[model samples]
Target: MTRVMNAYYSNLIEGHNTRPRDIEAALAGRLDEVEDRPLAEEAAAHVRVQAWIDETSSRGDLPEPTSVAFICDLHRRFYDAMPEELRFTEHDGQRKEIIPGAFRAAGEEVSVGRHLPPSASRIPAFIDHFALRYRGLTSGPTGRILSIPAAHHRLNYIHPFLDGNGRVSRLMSHAMCQAAGIGGHGLWSISRGLARGLRDPAEYKEHMDAADQPRRGDRDGRGNLSLSTLTSFTGWFLTVMLDQIRFTEAMFDLNALQERYTRLIADLYPGKQRLPQLVAHVLRHGEMARGDARFVTGASERSARSDLGELISGGFLKSATPKGALRVAFPLDYRERLFPNLFTDAAPIVPAPPPPPPL
Candidate 1:
């Protein structure tokens, strides 16, 4: 669910307005032919790339986050899975094809607002400098975590790819967080933080632009870029990350979540008892064998099968096969009840305050 939300908001930054529910449907293999198919494909591709990053990071197999290979690979994996229409962008009034895993052609000048990305020819050397500077940070968690936003802004300034630079940068930030041991296992997303900050996308852009400025004065660091501005942005980025982590931790409190789960089961099936026990068992064990559902629910085999079928059909539980092990499924429809406020689109329901005494 967090990955799906990440995909939604990250693409939302690019002006692709795919809804959360639509992304959910796409993940379920239900594509809408008219309006959603394209956005759905794009969102699905983002999720896949994120999943790849997480897997690689967990195995300690990911390339240094700032390396040329990692950046190009992120671009390649995403675009290679994207549909043809999403792979091209206008450059110099002409539609240019984006080749997966390839850098922009030499002499290409891409404009991002007032900022002109470095000439494509300089990208490799710039990336080499990036890797050399940041690769050492990986040895320490504090350095690794602190470098995420700096790395994010630097990569965007380099603008190595023909397109999808923002998505790739965000994914690289996520990979860095994981490598730094702060990923929270996909329970929170910085993309949501970036999107929700100040309720304005332009603010995020302005921050990135500020970091792209040349060193302001003697007080600033000796680097070409404004270290002060970059530090400010990194501070904001770290705040966002911490806020997301704290928010998710509050939501995942086991007692509160179990209470909500019980209420949701009762609301979904008015007369069906013993469903909460079954859900609690799966939630505790992460998964349960089909034959064991009867034991957990304290119901006969026929009754257990019926309840399990109902839960699966309602998108609350999922199984590989009809009689296979079942795992809890927190699909988008149930997110509001199960994990409130996890997505920005679904505001948590709070009761209205009582009217104040008459003045």
Candidate 2:
């Protein structure tokens, strides 16, 4: 139960004070956090981690600026469909805002202010290996939660998937943990860990600095990173991930939000066939509480309540009890998959860059 994964690569991490056992302990801790409240906000964090993991593990190379934009997209998508007001224009040259993802391609070598050389296109082939790598850590006969951090470091090293590399890389780590059962029926949200990592790359940059160094080559080695910095990055990253599992365990359960709504409307129309639809319409409109259910379903109040009530039973909509309000409730699994920062407000995640090129 305490198998440490990819331990030889410990040197790959920069400021590692944590042991393989420490990672194991963190995984167990994540489980305990959710046992008492299986479907609370905390569970949302676990789901969030898995979403990020899938995004990261699935892509390839990209330019630096593109990578940044890609990450912005992932964040936008992670939330519930996104409120129009939250959309920003400066994204991906798009006139509108959208979910962020990694670029997996090179960007303009220089901004308007600078005239850098034309950037090179990175290899996409690394994706196949990285994807296989995380799977090994997740499914092999001797798998462990440590793979979460390991995969993350490897993902960045590969630099697969352009724009959202950093965001997606962290997501991959969280996803690996969930698949590996590190969350114990819930999630350890490496994104939160990443939030911390982004807050301060110092400790993380210390880990795996050696491995991240630019490969010895002919050209383009001009501003490549050094081994020590890679090590620091690993330490800081793993430390942040360790902290994230604990933090995510304390958040609300995504299912609980929908269930409460379901229970409220179910009590109003126990035997209606169309309750589900009626409920869906009511919840969708948010402010349409006073409107007749017929507007939503072209049926009577009895018909509307019946359909909506059925939806309540089926978990499509929830009505306010004692207060008489209505709200939309997505499928539990759907909600978990889509809205990660459910309880938190939108805020930009800024990662600290590693110490400058080892002086």
Candidate 3:
């Protein structure tokens, strides 16, 4: 679910606000039900790329986040999963084909908003310099953490890819945080904060653009870009990250989370008195056996099975094999109630869809 939120917000930052239900359908291979097929595809692509990053990072096979290979691969993997028509981008009134994993070709330079990226010919040199500088940051957690925003802004400032630079840069930042061991194990997302936390997405772009300005006199540091603005952007970026962490932390606090689940379960299954205890058991032990349902609910064996079946059919729980251990499952309709304030379009509490009629 957090992964879906990350993907949704990342795409939202890029101005592709695919509905959460559509993204859920896309993940479930039900794109036929999605109205905005292209947007759903894009959101699914973003999720797939992040899954790849997490899997690769866990295996310790992920390349340096700043390395050109890793960065370009992030671009490649994302676009590779997108629909063909979405791979082409228009520039200067001419349609240009975007090659997966390839940098902008010479003479194919493009402008992003008010900023023009470096000439294609200089991309290799700029990328090499970028990789070298950030890879060798001071060996400590603080240095690693501080490098995140600096690298995020500078990578966008470079704009290596013609069309997907924003997404690529964001992915790179996520990779850097994970590499630094500060990514909260995918429990929270900075993209959510960046896209909506400030109440306006433009503020994020403004900060990035502010840091893009030329050096301000001498006290601003010797670099061509203004170090002060970069520092300001870094501060804002860190604040957003910290805010997300705190928000997620607060939501997940044991007592608070239990209360939320209790409320949600009651609302989802009104008057099913013992359902919450069964859910609590699953929450604590990760899964529960069919035989234990009666023990936990203290219901007659038949009634216990009926309750468990209702929870499963209602999408509150799932099992693999016939009579397998039951694990918790979060259906889309429950999201708003289960994780309030996490989404802007928090729907009013609604009962889970009724079970399919008897065949």
Candidate 4:
């Protein structure tokens, strides 16, 4: 559920409205004829890459978060799965193709909002400095968490890729959290917080743009950018991350989750008293063998099989194989009942508008 939610919000930030139900359908091998198929495919790609990042993090094999290879690999994996038509950016009536995993070519000049990224010829130097500065940080976990926002902004400021910079930067932030052991077992997402913060699109852009300004004065640190604004943005980002962690933790509280499941079972299968027990067993054990359902629910084997079938059909339980163990599954259709306020019906947030030309 968290992975799907992350993909939805990440795409939402890019102005793609691939709803959660549509994402779920795509994952289930049901493509939509009315909606653009490429968009759905892109969302699935985000989920796939995120899963890879999670696995890599778990194995402690993830590359340094700020490494050029890590950033480029993220771009490559995402666009590799996307349609060719969606892989280019146009500016000044000229189209520039985005080559997967390649840095922008020399002579390329890209502008993000009001700030211009350093010249393409200089990207390698900037990235080298970025990696050296960040990869060597000796901060503890709390300090590392606090450093994510500045690191995120700096990567965007560098703008290494020709396209998909935003998604790649966000993915890097997630990987950093995992590397620092702050990802909370993937229970929370910063993209959701960012998407929600951008609910007022202007404010979101304003905050991001604020960090792009050059050093305000001598006391603003010696870097080329404004350390104060960077610090402020970091605070905002961390607050959003902390809030999401708290919200997810509260939502997953054992008592509350049990109550929510009980109500859900009653609504989906009225008067099926043993269904909740089966759900509880799966939740407690992470997964349950098919034959163990009868023991857990105290129902006859035939009745247990019938109840399990209903649960699987309703999208509440998922089994790897037809007759294998069953684990909990949360379909987006029932997300509101099971996980309330997750997907809001609020207006879409637009991306940051281009900054006005300098005076």
Best by TM-score: 3
- lDDT of candidate model 1 versus the reference: 0.81
Say which prediction, candidate 1 or candidate 3, comes out ahead on lDDT: 3
lDDT against the true structure, each candidate: 0.81, 0.42, 0.82, 0.80
Worst 10 contiguous positions by lDDT, candidate 1: 350-359
User: Each model's TM-score, in the order given?
Assistant: 0.90, 0.37, 0.92, 0.90
**Candidate 4 residues 280-305, lDDT tens each?**
77887799999999988788999999
Q: Positional deviation of 89 in candidate 1, in angstroms? A: 1.1
Model 2 regions more than 4 Å off: 1-120, 141-144, 184-187, 197-202, 205-211, 214-236, 247-359
Tens-digit lDDT string for candidate 3 (1-359): 77788888998888888888898799889989998998998888888888888877788776789888899999999999988779998977898889989998888887877888899999999999998898888257888898999999989988888789888988888888788887776677678878864445687988888888899899997989999889888888887777777777766666666677778888878898888888878877889999899999789999999989888888888999878999988778877667776676464232332222222
Look at candidate 3 and give me any clashing residue pairs.
Answer: none
Those runs of model 3 whose alpha carbons end farther than 4 Å from true positions after fitting are 345-359
Give the Cα error of residue 109 in candidate 3, in Å. Answer: 1.2
Which of the predicted structures, 2 or 3, would earn the higher TM-score when compared with the native? 3
lDDT order of candidates, best first? 3, 1, 4, 2
lDDT value, residue 109 of candidate 2: 24
Model 1 C-alpha lDDT per residue in residues 1-359, reported as the tens digit of each score: 77888998898888888877877777777776326787888998999889888878778787777777888888999998897788888989898999998888975779898889889998888888888888886678789888998899988998888888899999999888887888876666788778766345576787898888999898899988888888888877777677667666767777777788888999888978778888878887889998898888778999998888888888888988877889987766677788776665455443322221221
Local error of candidate 2 at residue 23 (angstroms): 31
